[model samples]
Target: MDEHKSLADNMDEFRKLIQDLKSMSITMVDEDQAVILLNSLPKSYANFIDTLKYSRQTLKLEEIKSAINAKNIENKASGKSDADGLMVRGRSDKRQWKRNGNGLGLRTRD
Candidate 1:
């Protein structure tokens, strides 16, 4: 029927419109824009960035492990034990903190 054909045509057009809209909506950020966004962050975030930079260059395995242990112990003391019931776990251990990138921090695994 003509009605069925028209409906299919309309649906195809709608799908194409959606695809176009999605493609148009996403915009890539240039390096300068990224820098500006980073600059606009809070002082604490800036300090964190500095810490990360310093840590990447100067932190040793012992220092990173110590920090991870300290954070884990603190979390346990605060009653936030991880899945393996571990308070302090290391990178090469069975009960390790789920690492995000190369940062030294603790995160709960649910």
Candidate 2:
């Protein structure tokens, strides 16, 4: 649950902890596990957490895992780094240019 760690790494650590607890006769329900995972998310995941929390009546651990994996893939694809939590996006198309009243060139909005 470290903010500096990636989601996959955190989940792996969580799974190991759960396995250790199981060996000690401690167990948690799927919903509780899901809730713990959700609660462990970093502040950067606030929006995602809210959406998942309010959009479901019952939480499924498998579904949450799948969603997290998909989001991780999406973040990677969109030039976001998990450890740094940085995302960069920009338009690749040509921008229009126009001359302002002051005779200076300015980029026009699409």
Candidate 3:
């Protein structure tokens, strides 16, 4: 019975030591170290999401252009030509469409 009690106490101490070591290991891993580890990952995997986003955006742009061209062709085929009238007006018209910089100000230059 005494030997069993000693073994149980040793096991408890060993478990506590393991827990302390695990906590210390976590504490040693700082934010910068974590960021460095993330950055060190393979470039292909890191850029995977960005690559898919860019490809989807490009595909959408191409689709929009094709739609616009198809509409223009349909109008032309129907003998309804107003190409010159569709051209954008002068700079004054564009001035009103100026982007409101959301209070960031006109010049973001440092």
Candidates' TM-scores? Answer: 0.25, 0.72, 0.22
Q: Identify the superior model by lDDT, candidate 1 or candidate 3.
A: 1
Task: For candidate 3, list the clashing residue pairs, or say none.
Answer: none
Candidate 2 residue-wise lDDT, 18-85, digit = tens? 89999999989999999898898777777888888889999999888888788779878988766545
Cα deviation at 76, candidate 3, in Å, is 0.3
Q: Scored by Cα lDDT, where does model 2 land?
A: 0.85
Any runs in candidate 1 off by more than 4 Å, and if so which? 1-56, 83-110
Q: How far is candidate 1 from the true structure (C-alpha RMSD, Å)?
A: 24.4
Per-residue lDDT of 1-110 in model 3, one digit per residue for the tens? 12223323533554465469678884333333323322332332234324433555233423433443464466568775422233575644322233465844353222
Instruction: Give the Cα-based TM-score of candidate 1 against the true structure.
Output: 0.25
Which is the winner by TM-score between candidate 1 and candidate 2?
2
Query: Which one wins on TM-score?
Result: 2
Candidate 3, residue 50: lDDT: 43
lDDT of each: 0.44, 0.85, 0.40
Off by over 4 Å in 3: 1-59, 83-110
lDDT, residue 42, model 3: 32
